[model samples]
Target: MSARARERPGQHDVAHPAWTLVMSVAASSLSFIDGSILNVALPAIRADTGAGAAEVQWVVNAYTLPLAALILLGGALGDHQGRRRWLVIGTVLFGIASLVCALAGSLQTLLAGRALQGVGAALLLPNSLALLNGAYSGEARGQAVGTWAAAGAISAAIAPLAGGWLVQQFGWPSIFYVNIPFVGVAIVIALTRVEEVSDPGSARLDLGGAALATLGLGAATYGLTLWSQTFALSTLAGGAIAAGLALLVAFGLYERRLGDKAMVPLSLFGNRCFTSLNLMTFLLYGAFGGAMLLIPFTLIEAGGYSPVEAGLALLPLSILIGGASRMMGKLAEKIGPRWPLTIGPIIVGIGLALASRLAESQSYWTHAFPAILVMSTGMALAVAPLTSTVLASVSRHQTGMASGLNSALSRLGGLIIVALLGAVLVAQGDALLRPFAMALRMMGVVAALGGVAAFFGLSGNWRHADSGTETV
Candidate 1:
């Protein structure tokens, strides 16, 4: 090891720690940005390939569906194979997949490339957290997690604009091509600066648990996705949902019967702190994703902004939230994740409370911008500590699973919320133009629900951030 690599996590590690932090943050952000980026590009792709809404969703879902499904495996792989190794492997594959996506001539080919990209993302996502956990300790760990959260939020902010510009300038394929350079850089830095850490012992890879979890989430999420787009009750989807639930229940029961390393360490759930923290994160992140989806529609439909214009309008929100997340991490050390976690959704509610009043003539600067900014701040405050707590609340052995679960559940929450919101929208009448008053009322209800979840799932027994490491 280099002299700098010898430095312990909390101590003055050379600039190596900084490099690790940046690369990890950037790598994770790449996955998140991809999640939302293609959302904007869908229309261009649809136009280019003459695809419908359902088919276009495959382009997006091909990435996200698997990312959500197989994320836990990513964490397990990182722990078993060494975080750095899988990180490099995933990054390189992601780049290759992106190149294939860029060159795709038809919708089927594009979707194939997207599925490959998803596989790569699934591998990369959880390992990002595990790598960071191995790297930073104590206050530095807190800061590193904060950086990871901030990067994700910033990516959330920029994805639409960047995607829009790329699509406008060079069509939708450019969006896929754009990933090449970033992944290339990530692979190089991750290999050079990050050290290897792995479980050399016989750490059993619970393929059974992974299979069940994947099927469960896949069925449930896909059913929800279909419901979001089509408001009618789907018997097939409903059946899938039931089957998925059964598999998950079976997975849990199966684990209890095992002595070797189970896929999901059931013992981790015994930690009330960890469970509650993750539950809160799931709801809050749902609200965040729902808001991200709804606000842009509200902007273009009700606020009378062009798509690009609406995307630009959201810029303030991204800036405030990304900046606020880092600061909140510092504050979390003193106050703990619970208070901020509780406060964040409430603030988001307040922002949406204002947003609910949006009128066709509502001033963008006066109404839309402030609402998003406050909402962004609320989300920013909640995420970093929420993530850190979820990880900290679990035992070191299960930290990979804990981190993966938090990330996965948060994505799942978004899927569920968007489906629910779609139901609300569809029930209101399938109209492009939602009058300001009606939009306000709908958002108010959603915000209210998120606030309730925050208060109940995350409040009261908030942990003290300074409480050091204790096995759950």
Candidate 2:
């Protein structure tokens, strides 16, 4: 008859006596593949659109922006509605978007479709983790998450190679078209293996908070992109930068008035370990995201390699990143997550900084491979621990939201880094490229900035993340 007793029954119902680890991992992998696949298609996309650099940049930015800004909201939405229903809906929408992208006749249409796909991705990512949390408990939860992370790690490794081949053999459309078969398989598996669950009570959507957050993030990302045009502030760029900062501040005040979607649970910020861990995720992922953006082009523009060749150059690192993620997950449980997370990015950043110093006259093995290899080593070492640390920091109830936010922040880091770094390279290339030295130098600076954040921000005991907090 008591209020606390009534709440306990509903919360208890969310727990799982039977968990489906394979289903969770498979669902998570599909989400990861969707993200990594498009990157290899960017060059082919440039040729097909007849759009210049700035316009072509939108193809990547369009998907990344909505995906980043809305991921937390997506997680919260799932908690309010039915996570399974949302997951199925998300998968279907992604398929529709992928089809639209495949058939798009104009650049605008393709970008719109990519945005839809991003929305679907954001929807699916967090709910999948939330479902996983509901199914498993304690150490079983760790193993299930490890499986999910590993599956995603594998997909990230393979997407580049697969996407490159698809682009070369069939053309760019094949990249989008490939997603259709995946959608069917995922839907069938999810329907059969996953149980449906939703909150019986309703929660407010917080439209005002959502709008400010979206506009703020969008403006900030856009302004930084303008800066990439010429690190110096032109009249237009300066104006945009001012506008973005103003909007971002407005977003913060708005969120304070309302609340984060069920996913972020703003109170998590009160946990220093949680906040710091997220930053570490952002920094490491930014480096990872920026590398994905630049490395493909390096092989294509500088090395005379096809898209497939670029993917091939990345295989070593991709494989390593996955392996390292698995290793870090286990290690985090042992030595603690902070050490690896800190050390990994520093190593990767050093490699990137070294890469910035590379000579055009040098070959991949001599000039490029060293930095690439070192960066991969650092990345491989860091991902699992950083991810594990975040998951460990949060309450069981919000695991899905936490997972989604982790993924989103990583993508946001990439989305912004690529926008800025790519812009810088393009704007400066003409002026600096007669020598090729300056381009490399710029990359090193970018890499060093990422490393510095990882080192300073990753100072905490992720192992003892106060797991006693009650799940809301």
Candidate 3:
């Protein structure tokens, strides 16, 4: 790509920046909200469906697994086909899946619905991001991404509270039902407002690679989920893990053969900055996921708080992330991303350590708020810069794939950590509080390691990425 093209490619084509931002951000928010909305509702769902600990974890994992698995294909498809078309199809599919979830009669049925919801999310998220990347350029692009991240964080933050209120006023199913109208609005706006964007020069669809990825991730996640039930190494889980690993290995080798035609270009991983950023993403997001999974359970089951109270406890986290994201994005631009990325996760680790104190006391002010605030602050400092770095690391054509891969790794981290924690939760039983504290401490350690990785991995001059070229 030409230097001018690399720097200012998006500036020339964008027709409706404001509307594009609104629709893309809204569409993406549905996926974000869906990701976390079930956290507060998990207890209620368990009560309603007689789901055990393992099943409850499946309720979360069912959504995350496919999302992590197929997201690359989703991005590739959007780039090969059309972003707006896939966005609309994904929105519609998500709405339909939400309805199925709302009407599910059993835990099995709900898990099925959640899995389908994840498929829609895989289709939605990467394309929405690609649309955003296509709509703006340079500093405006950074600001747009910051705004998008803030909106997503706020939506994620509101999910638990909104879900709690819905469960209290109506029922647990109401959370799923409520998504219909919002999905409708998002679809209408997406069709009418967002411009069509796709790469005419993109490679053909990589169906074989997509299938391999799906099978590999599904098998691995299933193995982890089943392993969580026994804590001990079971033969079935062992086989599944081995099979999953083999399949992933096969997929990697196959992609290497395909070269640039691959769904995820192998060349992108050659960038040291890209690889490091994604590594940081995995560790930090995994810690965040494990901590989030525990919070509602700790509050409602052990701390004796109602669902509403549990949901409300996180409201300040939303506000802090939303308020601080743009400023931090600007800060990252001014001073570069290394220090903020390195320091931010360390602060988050401190926050998780503070949150571990919650196991001893249910005092919202003394125990919950401070820890949540600190974590939120750290996230605010990191998220936008993280996104900016990922996008900048690749060429314009690779935006969708880069975003999808980063998102997948991040979700995969969460998926693994949450499943592992679920096993611990089941083993602890009545002693939920102690295990919860221990899990927080473990998450803190993981997050601190992410900070350490960022410190060593990222460069002071990372803002200006290398020109997109085949490098090894």
Which digits, one per residue and each the tens of the lDDT, describe model 2 over residues 97-124? 9999999999999988988988888778
Per-model RMSD to reference: 5.0, 4.8, 4.5
The Cα error of candidate 1 at residue 36, in Å, is: 4.0
lDDT leaderboard ranking:
3, 1, 2
RMSD of 1: 5.0
Worst 10 residues of 3 by lDDT: 2-11
Indicate which candidate wins on lDDT: 3
How do the predictions measure up, each by TM-score? Answer: 0.82, 0.84, 0.90
lDDT of 1: 0.67
Show model 3 residue runs off by greater than 4 Å.
Answer: 1-16, 136-146, 394-399, 427-430, 459-472
* Candidate No. with top TM-score: 3
Residue-level lDDT tens digits of model 1 in 1-472: 3211222333323446777887787677778778667655654576679875456445655666667667777766776767678888888878889999899988898888887888788888767666777778887986787667767887878987887678767787888876777797777778667776665352446778778777776677667656655666689778877887888788889887774477666776676677766666666666666666656655554456555666677677777877776687778778655667677777776787777656566678887777887887877777656655665665454555666677777776765655454443332212534433454455555554655655565555544354345421
Q: Give the per-residue Cα lDDT of candidate 2 at 70.
A: 79
| Better candidate by lDDT, 2 or 3 | 3
TM-score of 3: 0.90
